[model samples]
Target: MKPSIVLVGRPNVGKSTLFNRLTRTRDALVADIPGLTRDRHYGHGRLGSKPYLVIDTGGFEPLAKDGIMYQMARQAQQAIDEADVVILVVDGRSGVSALDKEIANRLRHANRPVLVAVNKSEGMQHGLVVADFHELGLGEPVAISAAHGEGVRVLIELALEGYPEPGDGEPAEGDSIRVAIVGRPNVGKSTMINALLGEDRVIAFDQPGTTRDAIDVDFERAGRKYTLVDTAGLRRRGKVFETIEKFSVIKTLQAIEEAQVVILVLDARQEIGDQDAHIAAFIRESGRALVVAVNKWDGLDSYVREQIKGALDNQLTFIDFARFHYVSALQGQGLEPLFHSVDAAYKAATINLSTPQLTRTLIDAVARQAPPRNGLFRPKLRYAHQGGRNPPLIVIHGNALDKIPESYRRYLEHLFREVFKLQGTPLRIQFNVSSNPFADKQAPREKRRERKTTDKAKPASGSPARPRSAGKVAAAVKTKRPSGGR
Candidate 1:
């Protein structure tokens, strides 16, 4: 497994900006406004063959040390407990504040490998201002410009120096199916893992906080290789106010990142809430396989199941590719369907179709529905190729790739699954646009050219250019061309 790292800093200190730059994605919401990032966001990170998870945390404050902002501070402090390495980002333009000093002091007590980043130092003049941050006693600080992406490669290399993946000297490890059992606290995360292992693999408790570590247990089901990770149950900030449970939050976020297939376990009686949706967003953002399992599903009626799925469909609008199954870990009533959904999500991750078939499907999907627009450029996904497995990566080359909203992407994903029969597995759809969508439009241009030529060739005398209405155009097309031509 890859190591995990956390980037912590005060509000408006460029932590989220650095997160977007490192992850090469706008996964964290960025705005000129401060405190836009209310919760923790984690991203996939790598540098020169080393892969680690990076986390973007909420802002920290000095006056509100015991307040909500301080709760966020405690969360960042937990980053040290869970991370193999820690990155402390500070705004160089603002100089060093007392809050930064407090975070540095906390990290120093944790005794972990820490890297300090002085952000917003793009110009030569800011060098002197950034140099003052070295006084924090954490060696030379790396000056970076997160928005313009300056000095990020060096910062990533420095962050990964302590986190090299273990090599077995053989062909890379065979794809061991990763199953992340995730849900709200005390919802049987430990109970399911213990049942799977047939031993006391984790602490089974009615009280929350029974499991803090993201315990990964590798075993075989029949002949299939599997890794079942029981992550710490997630609790609301209102629930855990202390400084110590911060580590649990970090582990939970990292576990969501590392898992290949997330078994999003839901409490059968409870309606899914913001926390469940929050975790589902992690799986969706990570582009991993998703299987929505309604845990403790025994002794329920058809009406209840329908209510559950309906609630799920409404809340899980973003994850159109995920398959849902109601299950009881205690009785194992619906596990086969759940596992089958897992198998489908796994296949969806690596599902490959002939390029001809995919291109044809692209034609059909776009013909049925035009590409979603981003200003003038309609972000057209021209072609796609399946690149990776474990979680399938379909790289789509297009125009205005950044404008392809998550909803349109899901529309294409739904079409691909419906047309090609991709079941169960979570798949990643990557978009890249080379040219402007407006420039390469053929049908509109052809029609304009044809109309211009027709107008020029019209017997240019008193044959008045009477504009044709919709009904007139239809009637003329029917009369002039039996097959419905202009």
Candidate 2:
């Protein structure tokens, strides 16, 4: 397991900025406002080859009793308890405050290794900035500018100093298909995950935002391994008031990017909204293999089910490639068939495409219906080969391919999907327009040959003989004069 480094401090101390620097990703939202980060945002980072996990928590207001501040404090305290090392980020420009002292006092009892980071120490004297933080009773303070990326490497190095280098125990490539479950708030994502595992692996509460961090659970079904990533529910940005919810959306998006497949859970009792369509569009754009799960489907009447199906068709017509299942997560009604679709989707996403086969398919499709001509340019698709997998990419070599319209592209996509039996994964086509050999100028060898031919055809300015005849005559004259001297 990777070591966890938790960042704790008062608001606007640049913890989120430092989290971004450490993870080499802008997953954390940063602003000058206080208490912007409420929940624990987890990210992976490495120092050289040593991998570790970093957690960013909201501002620690230990004194607050009941409001959002108290909730943030609880989240931060949980992170501190789980941390292998805790870095208390402080504003170096403002000097130590009462809140910083309170946070320091709270961390002193955390029983974990604590390091004080004096942020925004770019132009100031490092020694002076760090001198004020040593009063917090934590060892030496490390001055770092998270925004400017100064001394961050040193801070992480110090934080990870004692941990041994990670071994090669990580799972091999293709060992398991990673699947992320994502959708709007309280969509029964966690409940479905628990039902799939046949155990309570995660907290499946009835309220929204119960699962803040994207939790990964490994399991096997029918001897096939899978890592199911249960991600936070994404709410609309306008309605997202808590700063933590904002970062939850980021974590969910990151989870989608890291997964090979996605299970978008929807509520059958509710009408499909713009947020649902937006999520579906994002999944399609991500190009991940998808399986839609309409949860709470056990009690809905036939009319309601039909209405829901119609809504899905009308709103999410773009994701026709994915398979949809009406599942009752509580009862586990339709999960078995859902898993079958999952395996099929994964196979389709990773299926190999040979050049000869792809080319043949392209040729057949073109014979059936040639691409429409754009003015004088007629697109001629020559051959195609597999460019990538897990959202298979087909790279086609052709002429005038840049002139191919969107409708023609869709036609090819549909043809390829049908031909290859790509049911659940989105297929992508990329055109490599073969440049004309003589469009701008002749080849280098052809240019050299043309120059030689021209030289042979055109005579010298003062003589009609070949260009080499003068040199041969000079050589003969020199030879005759040398013989007379001998």
Q: Please report the candidate that would top TM-score against the real structure.
A: 1
Of candidate 1, the 10-residue stretch with the lowest lDDT total is 164-173
Per residue, candidate 1 scores C-alpha lDDT tens digits across 344-435 of: 67666655567777777877888999876767668666777666664555677766778777888888878877877776555567776686
- Residues 91-188 of candidate 2 have per-residue lDDT tens digits of 99999999999999998887999999999999998998899888999999999999999999999999998788743322356588789999998989
Model 1 / residue 18 / CA error / Å: 4.2
Clashing pairs in 2: none
Against the true structure, whose lDDT is highest? 2
**Which run of 10 residues does model 2 get worst, by summed lDDT?**
165-174
Residue 126 displacement in candidate 2 (angstroms): 23
Q: How accurate is candidate 1 locally (lDDT)?
A: 0.76
What is the number of residue pairs that collide in model 2? 0
